[model samples]
Target: MLPWLLCALLGVLVLALLGKVCALTRSMEEICDQLADRLAGDTNNLLTLSTRDPHARRLAARLNVQLRLLRQQRRRYLNGDRELKEAVTNLSHDLRTPLTALCGYLDLLDRQETSPAVARYLDQIRSRAEAMKALTEEIFRYSLLAARESWDWEDVTLNQVLEESLLAHYGALTQRGITPQLDLTEVPVHRRLDRKAVSRVLANLLSNALKYSAGDLRVALTPAGEITFSNTAPGLTPVMVGRLFDRFYTVETGRTATGLGLAIAKLLTEAMGGTIQADYRGETLTLTLRFPPAEEKAAPRAVPGGGGVE
Candidate 1:
């Protein structure tokens, strides 16, 4: 009887040891599975241990907090990288125009002659220089707008703005022998906008149209106070249309275009709660400009006699 009792006690001790070993094995397997899952995860690879496991749960919570912070940092880094790339692209495009012009002017000046050809070359140089100046100014203006700053708005007349822009480009239009087709109806078209900014937008659009148009420049104002500028051109592709408002995107013309004109215009327009769009079909390019209607007190002035030149 004494021997049987000792054997029974030994058996009980062995069973208790086996239960502890089984529990340890199960815990180890769980930990290994969690580690594998975390390793396989693409992002935020913090393991989530069961709440019953106090030590593992605490570790997982700490890891999760760190992972979230890492994700936020990574997003910021990527965003900054993308913006830097865009800025570089814009800078390259802007620089290319002036560089091309400078080269052409230098080549012409190198020639030994005092003839009409030399005069033409000088004229080309002057034109290119002016274009470069305009491009620089436009870039500066866009930078100001992109700084996320606000401007004071006042009531401005749409017709007056259009007229001023037209007057500014009158000389160039006359030189090109393109008639100004003004289709303005008798209406009071006013909107709350920054006058100087809106003027720049219109000027940029008209300048681009005059530069590219082969013939027939039409400037039409609708009764609803919307403005439309259309010109005869070789038309634009779908790709060009899509990128019309993108910075440093120009048409496929071999001519020296800084490609920032339309981009600046678009930015200023949006800043003023207005919209601008392009419609191209065959050999025609039309730009539609829309804004809030003007106050009744701000009516358009009568068209001047002889269409006063700039």
Candidate 2:
């Protein structure tokens, strides 16, 4: 009877040890899950566990302290960023009023006749004023874009928009003695994107091409909804190509451009759940954009019946 009693006590101790270990394991999993949720979401919840394990409780307490510190830093960063963008927008807007007045005076001067030398000097001043005006306007546009909070997403007919953007720039391309080559897909490709944002993105890219293309431009849209804009840029390096989408980045020849074109495109494209990339290959520069397809199909929006380099 004594031996049987000792065996029963030992069995009970073993079972209790197993139960404690299982409880600890569960507590660790709970802490892990809560920690992940806290990181991904903006919430005030802390790690909560079922068991009263001293070690796990201490671990959760330490993590909660760290999370509080992290949240504080994140808040500070966001506030600073928001304030910077607002300041830029305000400054750019203020400069526009004076710039407009300066340009008005310059135009008035252009009308008055003078000697060839005086006229030549006036022309140089006028050109500088115009360039400043352009830079100011581009800065304004970029600042506005940077401070934008959201865009309305909808089903957009991808091919039609591309055609319209190309046609819009037709006159400019022709004036530069270059014809844009377009190979848009016949099949109607649709995507879920912000229409106005998409238009702005394409406009910026085409403008970039106009500013930098050696002598030709080619635009193509695949059936799968990939859009590519390719041109021969005579002196672009791999490093320049890599930073093409960076904010306020421009090449020596592209001084007239504010360098915000592709940056804004990238910002809006990624915001709309799209991808934009630039590649420089053997003197040719190519920009590609891919937008996710819509879950629900919609009819193509009406567009003018002409496409093919306008």
- Tens digits of per-residue lDDT, candidate 1, 1-310, equal 9999999999999999997666556655666787666554446556554435555556667766766786788778767855754584478467767767776766677575668887786778767776776566556545545543445478887888898899989999999988889998678677877787788788889888877788689998876768899888875675677787788778876256778788878777765666789888886888898875544333322111100101
Worst 10 residues of 2 by lDDT: 301-310
Candidate 2, 1-310: lDDT as tens digits: 9999999999999999999899989998998888999997778887888888899899999999999999999888778877876787788889889989998988898789889999999888878878787878877777666665555667789999998998898999999988988898899998877788889899999999999899999999998888999999988999999999998889988867777789878877766667899999999999999875754333222111110110
lDDT of model number 2: 0.83
In order, the Cα lDDT scores of the candidates are 0.71, 0.83
Best by lDDT: 2
Clashing residue pairs for model 1: 190-294
Model 2 reaches what TM-score against the true structure? 0.85
Native-to-model Cα distance after best TM-score fit, residue 11 in candidate 2, in Å: 7.3
User: lDDT for model 1, on a 0 to 1 scale?
Assistant: 0.71
Stretches of candidate 2 exceeding 4 Å from the true structure: 1-21, 113-115, 294-310
